[model samples]
Target: MRILLASPRGFCAGVNMAIDCLDECVKRFGPNIYVYHEIVHNRYVVDRFTRIGVKFVDHPDDVPVGSILLYSAHGVSPEIRKAARERKLQTIDATCPLVTKVHLEAIKYARDGYNIILIGHEGHDEVIGTMGEAPESITLVETPEDVDQLPFGPDAKLAYLTQTTLSVEEAATVIRRLEERYPGIEHPAKEDICYATTNRQDAIKALIGQVDLLLVLGSQNSSNSRRLQEIGVTTGKAAYLIDGKAELRPEWFEGVNSVLVTAGASAPEVVVEEVLEHLRQTYGATVEDAITREEHVTFPLPKELRVLQAAGA
Candidate 1:
C-alpha cells in the first residue's frame, strides 16, 4: 500500500502561538494557571496541559478572583473580556490574531448599523465568541439554504463575516448564495477563512480522488478538522477522523490500496508520524508527501509573555 501524507498538515501558526503561550505561562506562573477554554481543540494538547496543572474553565466566573487566566486561540468577545476584568483576574490573551480580526470586523459592522450575517456552525466556540460581539446585529447561517431564511429584507443594510476555520469551498458557496439573494450585501475587507484552513482543505482537494481512503488526524470537536473529513466524504471517498493510530481499524484498509493522511491545525506532527509508523508496520505502506502549498506564517507570542521575558532577561 502507498500512503500519501498531506504536506503543511498540523500545527499551523495560530496553534503554535496558543500552545507556546500556555507553555510560557506555565513556566513563569507555575501550575496554578487557568485557561478560559481548551487552548486549542485537540484532546492531546489539552491533556498535556492538564498534566502540567492547567485548569480549563467554560466561564469567566468559574475562575477564582485574582487568579491568572488565559484566553483560548478561538478568540472571546468583548463581553467575556469585561467579565474577566470585573473578576479582577490577571489575564493573558492567547487569541489567534486572525480570529481577533473577525471580531473586529463584527464590531465594525455592528457599529456601522449593518445587519451582520455570520457564516459558520451554530454552536462553534469561534462562532459563539464572534457573535457575542454584536448579538443583536448578527444572524448565524450554516448553509446556502439558511441564507433564504434570514429575517432581514432585501433593503436592509447588511455585511457578512465568517468563522476563521470554515471549509473554503462551503463558505464560498454560501457567500455566492448570499450575494444572489442580497445584491446589496457588503463584504469584509478580506476573506475571513484563515490561511491554514484554506491550505489544508486545498491539499485534501488536491489528493481526494487519487487515494482510496482519507485519514484526518484531529479531535472531533475541531472545526477545521471536521471540515477536512467532510471534504473527503463529499468527494465520495472513504474518510475517517481519528485522534491517532489507536483509532485505526484493519477493516478500514480492506480492499484499499492507497490512503491519504492529513492532520488538523491543532494536531501535533509527532502524532501524525505515529499514525504513519502504524501504517508501515501493519500494511508495509510506502510513504510520500503530497505537497499542495508551502506555508510560512508565524505569529508573535502574547504581549504579556513578551513583557515578562524582557523583564526576566
Candidate 2:
C-alpha cells in the first residue's frame, strides 16, 4: 500500500491556542478548571484531558461558584458569559479568533438594523454562539432551499455571515442563493471561513485523484472533520472518518492500494502517526507527503493567562 499524507492537516492555530489555554489553566488551577465544552471536538483530545482530572461541563451551574471556567474553541453565547459572571466564576474564553470575528460582525450588523443571515448547521456550538450575539437579528439557514423560504424581499437591509468551519462549497451555494434573493445583501469585509479550513480542504482536493481511498482522522461531531469526509464522498471515493488507529478495519483496504491520510484541526498528530504505523505494519505501506501549502499563522495565549504570567501569579 502507498499512503499520501496531507500537509496542514491537524491542529490549526486556533485549536492549538485553545488547547494550550486549557492546559495552562489546568496546570495553574489543578483540574479545578471546568471547560464549558470539549476543548476541541476530538474524542482522544477530550478523553486525554478528562483523564488528567479536568472537568468538562455542559453548563456553568455544574461548576463550583468560584472555580475557573474555560470556554471551548467553538465559543459560547453571551448568555453563558452572563451566567458565569452571575456565579462569579473566573472565566477564560478560548474561542478561535476567527469565530469571534464572526460574532463581532453579527453584533455590528444588528446594531445597524440589518437582518443578518448566518449560513451554518443548526445546534453547532460555533453557530449557536454567533447567533446569540444578536439572536433578534440573526437567521440561520443550512442550504439554498432554506434561503428560498426566507421571508425577506430583495430590498430588505440584509447582511450575511458564516460559521467559521463550514464546507467551502456548501457555504458558496448558500451565499449564491442569498445573493440572488437579496442583491444588496452585505458580506463580511473578509471571508469568515478561517484560512486553516480552506487550506486543509484544498489539500484534500489536490490529493483525491492520486489515491484510491481516504482516511480522515476526527470525531463524529467535529464540523471541520466532517467537511473533509464529505469532500471525499462527493468526489466518489471510499472515505472514512475515524478517531484513530483502533477504528480501522482490514476489509476497507481490500482493494485499496493507495490511500490519502489526513486529520481534522482538532485531531492530534500522535494519532496520525499511529494510523500510519498501523497501515505500514499491516500492508507494508510507503508514505509520501502531499504538500500544497505551508501555514505560519499563530495566535497568542488567552489574555487571562497572559496577565497572570505577566504578574507572576
Candidate 3:
C-alpha cells in the first residue's frame, strides 16, 4: 500500500503558542491551574493537561474567587472576561490571534451600525465568544440556506465575519449567497479563516485524487478536523476522523491500496506518528509527502507569560 502524508497538517502556530502558554503556567504556578475551556479541541491534549493538574471549567463561576484562569485558544467574549474579573480571577488569555481578529471585526462592524452575519457552526465555543462581542447585532449562519433565513432586508447595512476553522469552499458558498442577497454587504479587511486551516485543506485537496482512502487525526469536536474529513468525503473518497491509530479499523483497508493521512491544527505530531507506525506495521505502506503550501506563521506567547518569563530571567 502507498501512504500519502500531508505537509503542514498538524498543530498550527496558534495552537503551539496556546500549548506553550499552558506549559509555562503549569511550570510556574504548579498544580490546579484553571482553564476556561479546552485549550484546544483535541481530547488527547486536554487529557494530558488534566493528568497534570489542570482544571477545565465550563463557567467562570466554577472557579474559586482569586484563582488563576487561562482562557482557551478559542477566545472568550468580553462577557466571560467580565465574569472572571467579578470573581477576582487572575486571567491569562491564550486566545488564538486569528480568532481574536474575528472578534475585533465583529465589534467594529457592529459599532459602525452594520448588522453582522457570522459564518460558523452554532454553539461552538469560538462562535459563541465571537457572537457575544455584539450579540444584538450579529446573526449566525451555518450554510447558504441560512442566508435566506436572515431577518435583514436586502438594503440593510451588513458585514460578514467567519470562524477561523471553516472550510474555505463552504465559506465561499455562504459568502456568495450573502453577496447575492445583499450586494452592498461589507467584509473584513482580510479573510477570517486562519492560514493553517486553508493550507491543510489545500493539501488534502491535492492528495484526495491520489488516494483511495483518507484518515484525519483529530477529536470529533475539532472544527477544522471535521472540515478536513468533509472535504475528503465531498471529493467522493472514503474518509474517517479518528482520534488516533487505536480507532482505525482493519476493515477500512479492505479494498484501499492508497491512503492519505492528515491531522488537525490541535493534534500532536506524536499521535500522527503512531498512526503512521500502525500503517507501516499493518500494510507495509510506502509513505510520501504531498506538499500544498508551506507555513511559517508563529504567534508569540501571551503577554502575561512573557512578563513572567522576563521576571524570572
Give the candidate number with the greatest TM-score: 2
Query: How close is every model to the real structure, measured as TM-score?
Result: 0.98, 0.99, 0.98
Q: Give the per-residue lDDT of model 1 (tens digit) for 1-313.
A: 9999998899999999999999988888898999988899999899999988899999899999999999999988888899999999999999999999999999999999999999999888899899999999999999999998988888999999999999898899999999998999999778999999999999999988789999999999999999999999999999999999899999999999999999999999888999999999999999999998999999999998898899993
Tell how far residue 199 is off in model 1, in angstroms: 0.3
Better model by lDDT, 1 or 3?
3
Question: What is the C-alpha lDDT profile of model 3 across 23-133, one tens digit per residue?
Answer: 988988886799998999999999999998899999899999999999999999999999999999999999999999999899899999999999999999999999999
Q: Each candidate: what lDDT?
A: 0.93, 0.94, 0.94
Residue 46 miss distance in model 2 (angstroms)? 0.4
Please give, for residues 98-199, the per-residue lDDT of candidate 2 as tens digits: 888999999999999999999999999999899999999999999999999999887999999998888999999999989988999998889999999999
Count of residue pairs whose backbone atoms collide, per candidate: 0, 0, 0
Write out the backbone clash pairs for model 1: none
